[model samples]
Target: MASRGLKFVNIQEHSDARGNMRIVEVDGGLPFVPVRSFIISDVPTGKTRAGHAVSCDELLIVAQGSCLITARTAAGLEEHRLTPATGAVHLGPGTWLMLSEFEPGTILVTYASERYAETRFFEDYVEMDR
Candidate 1:
């Protein structure tokens, strides 16, 4: 999920006596395009999710709260502890991603180039080739 180009971005939060707002950039890089955007919320503690890959690439942003994403690839291993203020991470095709230790109200915002496909692999390190 967040095993690839997951880099931190700095964003300004607009907050007043009423509430706060966060703005995210939806732009993308070459070989990856934005086909859709969505959010995930209401995650429970000590639970893991996002055990899939894509033929296309994706960008994952922590819309709210914090969580850890571990991506294991033949290329190597990447782990991210993300907060809402954090930037986005790009997960490329053939990469395996796992989400765990989700703090309360952790919202995941994602941009994808392709619709969901089932041929992508689930996270399994030993069974894969780099």
Candidate 2:
């Protein structure tokens, strides 16, 4: 399901005795070429992160463990539970995101379409000029 510009993508996974592996590529599971990437982990239970919006597109993948992601936009509010098997979620520019309910050892990897810039982030959705 999709809300506003947010999309839930199911990436193809290959499994074997070695373990499981999933690949993301431009125009594939990932919609754009990423200029930056980051990993988030060690979040305490009941804590939240990212209560704001950005001017760049991003893809969030729960590489290990799980977490709950809530996104808000002009359209409405949507929630998703992300696990390794759940693939990834795409967040477009100006979409507000709040992540919480993190299980221990949860590792979230994010790919961004733009370079990191503090001015590109907005705490208030209404402040976005878009």
- Highest TM-score model number: 2
Query: What is the lDDT of every predicted structure here?
Result: 0.68, 0.82
Model 1 C-alpha lDDT per residue in residues 1-105, reported as the tens digit of each score? 444444444555688999888665545232355767778788787778876555567677787888898876546777879887666677776667778888988
- Candidate 1 segments whose C-alpha is farther than 4 A from its true place: 1-21, 25-31, 117-130
Q: Which ten residues in a row have the lowest lDDT in candidate 1?
A: 121-130
lDDT of 2 by residue, 16-120 (tens): 999988888787757888989999999987898887875778899999999998877667777889999888898888788889999999999999988887327
State how far residue 118 of model 1 sits from its true place (Å): 7.7
Best by lDDT: 2
The number of clashing residue pairs in each candidate reads 4, 0
